[model samples]
Target chain A: MDRNRRVSVEEVKHIAELAHIKLTEEEETLFTEQFNRILDYFSKISEVNTEGVPLTYHVLDLINVYREDEVQESLGEEEPLKNAPKREDRFFKAPRIV
Target chain B: MKTGGIEEKRALSKLYELTAIEISEKIRNQEISTEEYLYSILERIGQVEKKVHAFVTVVDEKALEKAREIDRKVRKGEKLGCLAGVAVAVKDNICTRNIRTTCSSRMLENFVPPYDATVIERLKAADAIILGKTNMDEFAMGTTTETSYFGTTHNPWDLRKVPGGSSGGSAAAVISEEATVALGSDTGGSIRCPASYCSNVGLKPTYGLVSRYGLISYANSLEQIGPLTRTVRDCALLLSVISGHDDRDSTSVNLAQKDYLSFLQDDIKKLKIGLPKEFFEEGVEEDAKGPVFEAADKFEDLGASCHEVSLPMMSYALAAYYIIAMSEASSNLARYDGLRYGYREENDEGDFDTVFSRNRRIGFGAEVRRRIILGTYALSAGYFEQYYMKALKIRTLIRRDFERVFKNVDVIIGPTMPVLPFDIGERIDDPLKLYMCDILTVPANLTGYPAISVPCGFRNGLPVGLQIIGKPFEEGTLLRVAYTFERNTDYHKYRPSL
Candidate 1:
């Protein structure tokens, strides 16, 4: 929330990790500079007093949209799994977690 | 009616220039076969596509085959759908079964969806031939089409200038007569900006009016698949085909289905139009303002009331839009890991984090990566309240501003874009300057209002669009107003001279 706080390179690296994006050293520096400028522009939002304004998540005022929980045909396992980089019998293969 | 005469050739050439409604009428009356119509459109594409670069993938053979199928049905005296045999260029973000639906990004270059989007299903049901997937900004993330990974789509009016984006290719295709009509997604003016630049009629329907089942998510809340065509009636016809209830998309509203083309009455009598004063202030180009104000005068001439109104919160709309869009994008794009559908690293030797990060780094373009990172920062632990939370609050205020104004005015009118199309690569490197182009257009997205951008007139040899925004789900009024304006002016009739 620091008004004039600049995004340090270390913070940029941390954020890239959180976003699952691997940045080269060059990208790190570029992002730091761009972030400072873009965030500085966004900081102007603090000037407005939104004291009692409620946050709007969706524009439509519809509440939870419910549907019948009946079974319907889906893209059988093979069609969707066809695009996976690595797949086992019928599932996507990923590296071991442990 | 000589077969090889010059007059016959000219008459046949004019067939490709007709609007979708006219084409449908001709087809119904047996005046033109679908095969003949497709041939003329394909000939026009051959003539102008090299200069425009509007399509990422042109399904020429498949389209011809589909046209032939429709022609056979016509010969059998069967009932035809509303848009039978109409050619439509779809923005690449919407998934098409077995077609390479890249969002003009390298990540999904080889990925093809197994199923069609709800909109595509509806289009197919209506017998509209899928022309091809059109070019777009990478992941629909940038203002100008310059950020497209497949290469920039040139504005048909001037090949050197950019077609405003992220739906630039759709706009350019309709302008250059490459397609009879096209579909484009608008999140913060993607459809309207390019429509303004390419001199076409583009509609961004109310948030949930059209199903988003097959659209590749950019900002889930702000984006909607809409139509871009050379005329307002064509826009409405396409909208009617693709809109309505779809349980597949949980957000799609089940509003009573209405024939949008029926709303295209050329009457704006007693229609109240509000002109936001801030949209005409300092940064807007004088040339762009001239056409908009003149269009408003024309509306008054047609017996409608035009008055200046103030929306003070509009100044903050641009910043709020970026924050909310980026935050949503960050979350939506997290599915692009090496393990799943999209681009994957070849080595495959690293652990999960390493593979995921490397895939994202290599797959996504620079702008997409930058927005994702900025969004991640905005939603991070210490900064969430400062950036994302405040942005949501401002969004509420902006929506309230529109609600309050619409109490007195049936619709609001302004310039779709503050300036004309710029030279390609003019503002690509400067991200802030590029973001400023959406200043006037984002308020509609923020509030999820239905808005249309229609070509008003030319400025400095380029086209200017006058935007008409209606109350939420009031697309009928918006289309009617735009249709009336088209009747009064010849701006929409001016071809790009490609």
Candidate 2:
């Protein structure tokens, strides 16, 4: 919860890589400062006595909602590909992994 | 269309001043031509849209064509839907088939949806014309429309100020008379905040009450699409048409959907109102705080019991809300890899990681990027428990805090925002300052309760929203309280002179 504890530039770059976002030099600096300040205030939650308090993953009381498995109309073959940036024989075309 | 008197003829010209119910009735009765009404709306958009950039896309041709179809239906002696050829502005985040469903992010600048959001289907079924897609904060992340990739939507009340966001465009559209009513997704005050700032009515329905079927995901667990309108009853009317069980959204509650309009009345008799003390604590200016108390007094005058309640965990609600929202956002937005849709670079070649990173960098705005990185950090191995899990645990306590207060009270009341609509560029740079504005509104979203913002009173001519949060699935009760308050006050009727 120490406000002073900061994510080093290396950590930020590492997080950006993990998040799949390439940051400009300005964004990197801005984010590094912004993230730490946000984390600092967000750390206020740590002071709460949440001992034995269960995590609320969802607000709905229902858990494991079950519905009968039934075949339904889908978006159809061409509908899904309509927005594809590139399509090759009904397949989404992408730069191949090297 | 008959306009016998000079007064009547004059009134007919400002059809934008009429409520959706009135407009629909006029269209149904042949007192007004739907096509003509659409033209006036388009003209109004052209007139004021320069000052209030509320829309990202205006489907004028499509809307006029739809209006003509409705006029023909009217001529055929067909029974009309409740909306009956009314124009409704949609928040861009809600997918409309063939209309670009940009989240006001460059990531999806040109991505036209292949399907209609469930609400859009409902609105269309009700014979409502799609006026256009309203602007919003990029991915609904910021508290102001300033983050909108297209441009900021200025407050209709004061062009120099912001229309509160991320549903600013929808609220502005309704207030500026550009649309009859608009739909906005409220994760954390996205609907109510704008309504508060714009002197309009906005409701964030109970979780699962409105189907989120085609609403582009932001924070799946937190947000719900609801209505923004000029009056509380219109909010209820819109709510009724859009709410029901939809199997398409697995989380949509299967239950008998009540007629929200049928439940509204000028009554709050015996209602127990709890004004959470924390909501009034810091950051709330007198302009924002005074009107809510005045509203509570009015409720008491009408036989409702009012008292102060404390939710000790309230201080941490904002932090917990941000953590959960950002975490969900980071996960939900991961699908925008651009292969299937959205913005992607074609000529610049690289492997998946290299390309995706580049696309996302160019795709997202600064605020969005800030959230993703912070979320990734929170969900990372070492800090996950300390931040996210702990935040979730705090969420439990926050819900319990509300539960404890709700046992003795029917609804919680407070200012929808901490301050009146501020200058356009005032706090956009300070993310924390903007987040603080939502401190009063986030508790409902955090707990999945239905909350409605009604114009209570204004400070220095600016509107203030009185937020009434009710029990889960009790939107009927929330709307009733707001309707009761609105009936007794003239605040909701205050219009900005454009």
Q: Per-prediction fnat values?
A: 0.81, 0.83
lDDT of 1: 0.92
lDDT of each: 0.92, 0.89
**Candidate 2, what DockQ?**
0.78
Candidate 1 lDDT by residue in tens digits, B352-444: 888888999999999999999999988999999999999999999998889899999999999999989999989998898999999998999
What share of the reference contacts is kept in model 1?
0.81
Instruction: Estimate TM-scores for all models.
Output: 0.97, 0.97
- Candidate number with greatest DockQ: 2
Model 2 lDDT at residue A8: 70
Model 1 alpha-carbon drift over 4 Å, by segment: A1-5, B1-11
Local error of candidate 1 at residue B207 (angstroms)? 0.9
* RMSD after Cα superposition, model 2: 2.1
lDDT of 2 at B424: 88
